[model samples]
Target: MKRSAQPLVAAAVLAVGVAGVFAILAMRPTPEERPQVKRAPLVEVMSVEPGPYEFVVRAHGTVVPRREGDLVPQVSGSVQWVSPALASGGFFGEGEPLLRIDPADAEVAVESARASVARAQSEAQRARRELSRQRTLAQRSVASQTNLDDALNAERVAAASLREAEARRVQAERDLSRTEIKAPYAGRVRSADIDVGEFVARGTSVAKIYAVDFAEVRLPIPDSDLGFLDLPLGGGPGGGEADGPRVLLRAQFGGEEQMWEGRVVRTEGEIDPRSRMVHVVAEVEDPYGRQLASAGSGSSTPLAAGLFVEADIYGRRVERASELPRIAVRDDATVFVVNEDNVVRERPIEILRTQSDRVIVGGGLRAGERVAVGLSEVVVDGMTVRPLAVDPQSRAPMDANQ
Candidate 1:
């Protein structure tokens, strides 16, 4: 009976303690709930303006002469006198005497031929007089018909001999003229192998020369780049500079940069089978002529042959095109366009041309449209952002921040 009473007393104490704890928790105030706040990303944006855009195609080539070949002599003889203009790097005018061979032999030959012609004329006159005398005698019954016939034949033979001698005289005169070698055109001498008293054979090359009136550069451009240029299908419209496109050629000269203006004169009829490139011939008029004096341009330097050059060919103009920074465009021709509220979305644009640092957008864009030039790489579409307007040229943030 004593053990059962103790157990009942312990259970009553434990129930009282539990009731006291619940009453204390019920008296505490309820905690207040709070909300979380998120900020949008900051992005650099630029306003795109659409207008006419001119495209340029670049290529490289080496300068070359329009006409170049070996200078060969027509007649063979020892070079008695060599002109100063016949040496290497020398300039000469059209028909200028380059050298003179020993004309003593040629002059003697001419004189001898002339003397022979004079003797033949004397013999021919004598034959004619004898033939007339024979005819008179035959009519008077003094000379027989056989003698008349003989005189007539002799006269004919003498006339033929006179003609032969005249031909020899003409030939000798022509040979005498050939002894003095003259330049065929106004040109510069590339090299010379003959000098005073040097024996050269007929049709032998003695020097090299090239015309200096103009220079031609064979510029090979990829077949795909043809669309940018306005070229005729068959070939460039003739060899003159009257038509086709203009090319600005640049090169290093006199330890400085230089520029020359040229025109597309023609293109090769057949494409290069190996490279699949079309070779267009550009002509620069008066390459050795005077140039405008300017600083840092080496303007006085002539566009000499064999100099490697870079060309910038002016192409057609595209209307309603926008120019954008290269980074703003992706390889798949898409860009991020920001809206008025700074929300971003991807937009596809037609890329007319691509350069090292810029891209020409031909269509699918309008004026006053904002393009996000700088943004997070992993930013997704329809994401909101803090827009910062920036200058396109300097790339510095402008005063406006949307």
Candidate 2:
């Protein structure tokens, strides 16, 4: 009975061990239970457009009066009165009186000259009567020829004295008239340096005036641009022109667009020593009283003297050049162009001109080629890209990868 019990216990222990081994095998991991990795998303991008480009140059310049003059008193006198409008930044018309100098002294000189002329005239009349008497005595044989000749000479001397006095009087009158300082041309007064009761000397500057009929804009072009500029090689209107190149100038100021029709007036004859640029002058009409006034009136728009301005000189327009958005151009003058296979090709370009928002390409681009606009990424040659099609109606992105 004990032997039978022992066999029964051994069988029960073997069954328990087999159950434990099966549980351990179920909890262990296999090769197929490991975690799997996720792939990154593709970078969505836009397309590029290609076309003709142009070359352009930019420069800075200043505005100046077409005609400027200094107001100087020709005659010396004490200042009697100054014009109510005579001050810095004043405007006046042509021939307007800017200041009045005391003319009393000049007038007195004139009067004294007139008295001298009168005295000389009286002496000449007495001499003529004496000459007549001498001639009669010589005819009657009562006087010698020498005595008559002496009398005639005295009369001639008196006549000469009277003419001299008359000439002095005329000069005195001219000096008196000059005591009033008048404007030389129609313009605005830049400054009035004299006032009432101030003593002014001859040839002293009393004021400064600038003509407003027209204004001048000076542009500095590099020596390289000299070939494209149609400058007057010879002198003509401003000097003279012997059939030189002609350039068109378009000027914009204060939100208003103005077209000034003029040719290159002249060059500075030499390059600037400091900037190595040649100064070119262009004449612009100030018809709206923007630059100057007819009389001493201030400018309505006040294009004051020495104002800086931007000038655009229209060079030869390229008929076949393509226009592109400025952003399409890279720093190395290369652009991303989409080929027929939708692969981006980085094509090198030559920039002709860069306007406000567009660039004109001169080389390495043809008309009607698709180019990228406003792209901000590192684009390489033959890179696969999805071009976002642009909607013609709304100018917005229509679809991705079109």
Best by lDDT: 1
Q: Rate the local accuracy (lDDT) of all candidates.
A: 0.86, 0.71
* lDDT tens readout by residue for model 1, 1-402: 998899889999999999999999999899998887676888888999999877778889998889999988777788999999888889887899998888888899999999999999999999999999999999999999999999999999999999999999999999899999898877899999988988988799999999877898888888888888876557757544667788999998888999999988888898889999998888897687633332344544688988999998777887779988898898899998988877898899999878788888998777898998887545668999888888987779895564
lDDT of 2 by residue, 43-147 (tens): 232332343323434555666888887888888989998987678777676788888889999999999999999999999999999999999999999989998
Segments in model 1 whose C-alpha atoms lie over 4 Å from true places:
1-37, 119-164, 236-239, 290-299, 355-357, 389-402
All candidates: TM-score? 0.77, 0.64
Q: Model 1, poorest ten-residue lDDT window?
A: 290-299
Model 1 clash pairs?
A: none
